[model samples]
Target: MSNKTIKIGQLDMELQSIFSAFEHHVHTAVDTAAEKTAEEAVKKLKKTSPKNKRAKRGKKYKNGWKYKKTSEGMTVYNEQYQLTHLLENGHDIIINGEVRGHAAAHEHIAPVEAWAQDEFPEEFKRQVGKG
Candidate 1:
């Protein structure tokens, strides 16, 4: 390699361009990984969510899983927002304003959360490696 000398202003511009390209690359990889994880979380949630097969209108919690792209980042959520926490953590079954028994939690979101914690890092590495 031949040695070259550059002026200060030119050096600054060159460094800026190089940094910009690198920043773009890193951001693209991170965004791709986040999107993949979000999609997978939705799919897994749909699979694991409780469903009422007998419902005439077929309004199942499994079908309520959704993902959103936000200014902050990706997000996976249930369209049946009110039921998520109750279903996940279980709640007392009440009848006529009196407690009867407890409903067992199905444990859907927790498992997906555990999976994502492991999945995101691997996905990011794979995406970056694609370069």
Candidate 2:
């Protein structure tokens, strides 16, 4: 009769366990990674948004943008609202929405200029005075 013993090292056993665990949770790992990325993005956004004082608010997500509220505001994600650029005036003041970016010309509304000038007295004054 012959007898033989097979031995696996501690490191090899640990590696096997880790690989098995990783394989078992592969789908969860991917989902968790995506969720974490989204969570981080929201956290970054919360840092910049006004705490709680907007009758209305807006977000712009185009090409690395930032928003600073001089006054209180509120926003509903898909709703379009009026916006004026701080740097550009050649184009008429436009209306925009926060789909995935900060305000830009692509979502601009031509009629919003009239509304801003006529309806939002204070906002209209400030923007016009800026010119």
Candidate 3:
């Protein structure tokens, strides 16, 4: 019988290449997923936003929703308007130190949150070819 020795150097190199490829794929998939999520969130926000009756023809609250990508992830926000937080959380419409009424919260983020929770994992999985 002839003695045979296994060479692990080639196997290690092949594994390294495979891991590198996998890393690249994962990064690309995550970036794509993030962008999609942001876009979907903005769309949902716009669809669910409360219409401002007093808004001018070119100044609609729904059109304020926008998104941007950050180093950690994507963020959905209103670039032109700053009342998103108040609109989402609601506030007491007080007059002359007396509580006249309350403005009900018009939720937009909650739906987006639910959507991301329910859909993000699957989307990421699909993108990464694990679905």
Candidate 4:
């Protein structure tokens, strides 16, 4: 990347390569930031995830939180997939296929999501600075 003053044959190619490299650098930084933020969210979710002692379940949902990288980006999921939405948003108490009542929503995901939303930018900045 010179001054781009006088006419140069390789100037265009050089500029393209430079820009592409910078783009790649930024993309890597973003991905790093996304992963860190996602990990933080997963940890927070695990800590805050509810443990229903009364239910004769195998274990607490606390340990099931995990994050994965998708084509779109990072995705946080519970290994206990069947209970995630039900626990987060509350569910209808069904008895033999009949809705009897509603379970109270014990919000464990939303707060972490909000924190991630606020944390990603800072994490991106930190990653880029390190780069």
Which candidate model has the greater TM-score, 1 or 2?
1
Better of 3 and 4 by TM-score: 3
Tens-place lDDT digits, model 4, residues 13-119 = 87888889889989999999999999999889988888888877735577888899999999998888999889999999999999999999999888999999999
Per-residue error for 4 in candidate 2, Å, reads 13
- For residues 1-131, write the lDDT of model 3, one tens digit per residue: 23545478776876687788889999889888888888888888878888777667444678788889877688888865677787889999999999999999988778788897787778888899852
Q: How well does each candidate superpose onto the true structure, as a TM-score?
A: 0.87, 0.27, 0.82, 0.82
Q: Write the per-residue lDDT of candidate 2 for residues 101-120, one digit (tens) a residue.
A: 33224322223333323534
Instruction: Report how far residue 42 has shifted in candidate 4, in Å.
Output: 0.7
Stretches of candidate 1 exceeding 4 Å from the true structure: 1-9, 57-59
Better of 3 and 4 by lDDT: 4
Off by over 4 Å in 3: 1-7, 57-59, 96-98
Give the poorly placed runs of model 2, Cα more than 4 Å off.
1-21, 49-91, 94-131
Q: What is the Cα-based TM-score of model 1?
A: 0.87
- Is candidate 1 or 3 superior in lDDT? 1
Residue range with the least summed lDDT across 10 consecutive positions in model 4? 1-10
Of 1 and 4, the candidate ranking higher by TM-score? 1
Top-TM-score structure, candidate number: 1
Cα RMSD (angstroms) for every candidate in the order listed: 2.5, 20.2, 5.0, 2.8
Candidate 4 TM-score over all chains jointly = 0.82
